[model samples]
Target chain A: MKRFIFLLCLFLPALSWAQLTIQIQKGADKPLSVAIVPLAWNGPSLPEDIASIVGSDLKRSGQFAPLPSGNMLSMPHEASEVVYRDWRALNVDWLVVGKIVPMQNGYTVQYELFDVINQRQVMLDREVGYNDSLRDVAHAISDKVYEKITGIRGIFSLKLLYVSALRDAQGQNTYRLMLSDADGAREQILRTQREPLMTPNWAPDGETIVYVSFETRRPAIYMENLRTRARQQLTNFPGINSSPTFSPDGRKLALVLSKDGNTEIYVMDVATRELTRLTNQIGIDTEPAWTTDGRSILFTSDRGGKPQIYKVSATGGNADRLTFDGTYNARPRAMPDGSGFVYVHRESGDFHIVLQDTKRGVTRPLTQASLDESPSVAPNSAMLIYATLYGGRGILAAVSVDAGSRYLMPSRFGDVREPAWSPFVDRR
Target chain B: MTYKNLGLSLGVVLAMALAGCSSNKAADSANQNGANSGLGSNSSSTFDPSANGNGSNLAQNGRIVYFGYDQATLSSDGQSVLDSNISALKSGSQHIRLEGHADERGTREYNLALGERRANAVLQYLVANGVSKARIETISYGKERPADVGHDESAWSKNRRVEIVLN
Candidate 1:
């Protein structure tokens, strides 16, 4: 049982604090103003601050601007003692107040949301969690509040998967596959190796993951179950074997292989290990990602002399180019609804993450960072996390899909890259 | 006399680094020398110009071949470097591995493919020049491993290269 946590901390050595510090770089031009008053404690002071955590979560989303607690005219823990005029005086459109009550083995956090503009109560909810799980409860509260206001699901409770490489004194590198909360807490390293690992992505089931590892001295695709810790190498081809992405249905894995002489896209049946080559081109055809319906695949190819996103039938067919605006576009991951995708777009020599809406035929860059790449959209499609260089070290940065909110999650040590946001897990 | 010994030690170290046999020390030397000796540099000679007369020195000169941005074709300078080491390559029966690499600019998976393309290009050149196809193997590290850690073009140009490692 003790060995369970060591795997989580193997690559992050000698660091007392391993959590990534979240720095909000930008927010929406006109963010909604909300006040989250500090929750009143009924018993001895708890370890976690529920209201503060919830407020930070909301603020990081870039849609809601959490008002400073110092500016709250009146602190109302319950709806019965509410005062709308006080919140209105501060120009706050929404109000949130909560209180903590210790239970037998855990605590219950009761919170209320009010519409300052209409002078009405929007919601009254309570969450119960143990001491160590208090942060999760806070995220759960934030999810509820955000969904109530935006009519879209919140990703506060989701997980993030990324790879961090730490170079030793000898300049040799050790790569670690890390799993953490969306806000960069509870970091658990699933795999660590001296060789390189890339293109880690979650299965739709949220219990398994696929990534390319050079552990065997060559590129190979590997699948690991997060619960049992069981590992299996899925592809061991002679040439390049990489870019393994699980299909939406979790049945087939779309990947790239150069076994037949050149880089090409292929799909492998997860159960039987059957292979289906999808793209046949002399040029490089790689980075296969499944569309929302799992009926077609989107991949990056240099068939047109420059890397561009192309779409092809999942079974097999001619691929049609999807991106026309950029001379260099690659690594396309479609949105949840198949309405749009996010990819690496090179404009004026700088690589930035851009979102393309297929339904509306509109494309926009979501980040201003010069070297941004590996954009992984959240389960809800509200935000995305990508790898970028900050202060000459690789760090994970996030941006809202609408380009409204921007934040940087810099690790305490080494370089973090290729962040894959997990799907919404059914906690029940 | 001490300078001769130092040169001998550096030659062994450079050989191991070029052969992909040594670890951190080799990578460190690659970083230190790649920028100076890389094809992107205006000066092509890595060591003393007078040392070019020796076979071992010619082999060392041909140990690395750099490429332009998003390019897999061998430049004239690259071809000349390989031509100098052809005698040493043909004389040895040892197998070789061409480790391809790319700078950290594009998507990693694409870079992996690009690196492979570059290695294949090198392999073709060697095979066409009389090296047996079976004697050479190729692997692309993509942008995962870099000859230099710097982010500037100077480092990137050095990183975007194929290393000829003799086993």
Candidate 2:
């Protein structure tokens, strides 16, 4: 089977690290405070800093606040070497001790998670990958540690796609659709267009990504495979062909095209390229996102005279208004658990991310940002990343599902927007 | 002689850093430079010192009609601008491109639809004023193209406009 992991370089290498600076505004009230004891390195050198990766992963989730490496009193390479008393004195909930041994073919990362109160080892597992892929191995270790503690699968290994824009000194605007690690590292540019690029979405199978580009001097949908780097123009109709979203099954793509008339939703088969018109509203029916079950599509329509989140059957029918509390609610992204969805909710002239519980009939704002858009829920539905303005500069930020913790992924150079966190990839 | 064409190239410098892999883009931009040099010189010679902006000033000139926040309908000022363009819009020899835009507010996709609606409103207005529908083509840049880079209303009102480009 072909894995969707990116191991190829078809574009000039993009920058790494330092681009997305993290600022932890808040986190879970009772964050599982832990100490990540610096691991003993047994290699000539290391391509990846495993300890920092794991620590950042845990901290980014807003679940665990790792003790700074400088504060760790003892640097234990193994659980047997760990002084449990030292951690208990620090009042840390857990202690993570690890070691890296260089193998002839690759390297083995052996890590152990210990419960401070119980005074016992909880997780002891080893992952082996080529030294070149140590970053992936580190993320795999983070996933294990996270699941062991929270009982929820971790999404540290998944990828995130976003668009960044910069105005060159030559008086021209430059845009880039970038792919990066969940921690905002190893950014790779997928495509470059002179006009504008918008709304990058992932295919359910995790193989290809769809986005709207004005390369042809008009808004049209395009898809590019992550593995092959092959691109194909999906739609080039007369009018607009924007907001392309892959259906839950990955067999179809529901998008907004203004060919037949005003902006409306249409689904096209992936293989045959056959089109199925979904919404036929003259008023505006755009931003078509499918529910997890694939039976219905949630979109934003202005047919009622105000932009509101509405749901229509996949085949086409009446669109029931799902949001009423706010005067403006657009960009509805369905969570994986079938429990309502998230969208940009505008109130008092400030726009924030809000989660609407479909079954419970309750909606609450999750972000306090005055200007936020393009919210993408992680594969595990535990967190989401969206674009918002920070100090007049556009940046990407993440918020936990319960609105417990938040972090801003601020780009150092230009404005960043339209972030689409990838679906879960490493099922192993 | 009445007005010098301010002659801005409007850079179209939209760069998508799809990375340096675009080895042909250098060549493409070179060719674009060659093709636009004539227009550049023509406008430079007719340069009106009073006109502001050094970049794509097409949208900044009087050809654009501003709109209210979030509303696609035309205001009297906007209508008057289009009213002044009636003679030119009715000229069978001219092809008009109505490029709609929006302020940096709301979701990008929704703003795109709104921009399209705004453009269509302009197209409908022109058609009602005796301009042939076949002579006009419309596209919405959403909030991508801004006349002014500022985030306040002064910048937004100018960004939220429809530009009538004649070719």
Candidate 3:
């Protein structure tokens, strides 16, 4: 009986790993055509098709148009297989081929990238993973191929943290904090509660997450270690406690608190729990985010009578208004490159995610969907995921930073929002 | 106006208020009367927000005040609801908890601040009307806890509110 229960427990998580459906709305005007051939397998039949996963990852970026496997004239696993003429004939700019060989306990995946036009091998690499982790191995190969072809780091291996809520017939909501791969696969529920959960963000190290929860019938900030599943309530102030963002170094957290009579920006040391008040204006100051260098914080404030993005030094000082193009702009998220920031801008009563290039003094809207908010950019700054109302349901959507690609990730269960894209972490 | 006349006017205003919203009318009317009669003469027999309900249920109803979108200021209707409770709030020994909420429209964190501003508005009004500051506690739930889950204006109007919990 114990062994049967153990097996059931081990398999239940796999059975419950529901994936979000991806609907590509738009792609680049001239996406590079690439072909990822089926990786030849020399082992027991694997449950996952590694090549297909890699192909999907690359195609989802909107920078590449993966060729259908049926269109491929020949499948070459190595550079020596030649036959470059076949790929050239297919009008494929890039080609990827690999093979999976089973070892005693794991599998070895060897993949090679080729420039069909140049007829030259671009990259050759191998990765090893256990039976259950073939997906990760495939993602690593995708990352390598994406980087080699585009000269930009890939975000396929990154994870996403978001909140999913389902309202029952009684109108009571059940909220779940969910984690999944950037492609919306390998989903895992981090926490579930009867109360609402909001503003979940990852620490820079990717080992800890901080979020606001109303589990105590009052909003409070909490942090949980991912690897150990250790949970700790970080703040339980008298009033609103929310929008906790980790500093780039992960040693401090910038958040908003109303305990001091009005909502104001504050920073807390992660180690000693010491607090430092940063803003003293009577306006509603909240949604504090750190700059890439950790020297300043960008936040939302209404001191000027409408919500707008503002910036202040990390230690505490006067804030300079950062947005002026819109009457209502709030929830500023600094881009990974520090060249610009992304925020919610109200345009003709519809809220859309807009990217502000600080250096160029130019602003661009990354999403056309109405009611778009809570944008979290990938570590590589190539793409961003945000929550948008689609068909009256709150679903997650992704758009490339340059506004070339767009896709929606609607879950099978309920409303999903507040997508926080994870930083790149070493899986090995 | 006489206490009875005041109760009658408040009741009429509350009925119109309840009629304007698409939520549960019976519940809103009952609560509206309960909020109005808390400070006036305890003769809740004639001014019950509900048609068939008595004074016993008055304390539980009428504790919520609605607001406009992205607004933290108290509406005249909200002020009337509070004005009716002035005596009861000033004399009551129970702690007053003002829980603020916002509709699911804008960003969550900004809504948090907006909710706080709404609750603080109510707190300032109570303090200005002779209620001790020590008797009240305020908290903002932002858009997290929506009284009405619908996405339209009818629901959003109902969700943007402050509930007075006497404990």
Candidate with top DockQ is 1
Error of 2 at B91 (Å): 1.9
- In what order do the candidates fall by TM-score, top score first? 3, 1, 2
Candidate 2 residue B55 Cα shift, in angstroms, is 20
Model 1 clash count equals: 1
DockQ of 2: 0.27
Worst 10 residues of 3 chain A by lDDT: A165-174
Question: Model 1 over residues A1-428: C-alpha lDDT tens digits?
Answer: 56866554454533435658899999999999989999888677777888888899999999989988887878889998888889888999988888888789998889999988999999999999998899999999999999998899989988889999876433446788888889998787777787889989999889899998988778899999987868899999988999999988899999999999999999999999999999999999998888889999999999999999999999999999988886899988989867799999999999998999888989988888778999898878888999999999899999988887899999998899999999886665
Off by over 4 Å in 3: A1-12, A17-19, A426-428, B1-61, B90-92
Model 2 per-residue lDDT at B7: 11
Per-residue lDDT tens digits of candidate 1, residues B1-167? 22222222333344543443433343445445443333222122232122222233234456778899999999997898689778777767766778899999999999999999999988999889998888898989899977566788967887788877665
RMSD after CA superposition, every candidate: 6.2, 7.8, 7.2
CAPRI verdict on model 3?
acceptable
**Candidate 3 lDDT tens digits, B15-121:** 33323322345354434554554423332322222322222122223567789999999999889878877777787676777878898888988988888889998
Scored against the true structure, residue A51 in model 3 reaches a CA lDDT of 88
lDDT for A417 in candidate 1 is 95
Local error of candidate 2 at residue A406 (angstroms): 0.6
Q: What docking grade applies to model 1?
A: acceptable
After superposing the true interface residues, what Cα RMSD does each candidate give? 8.8, 7.2, 10.5
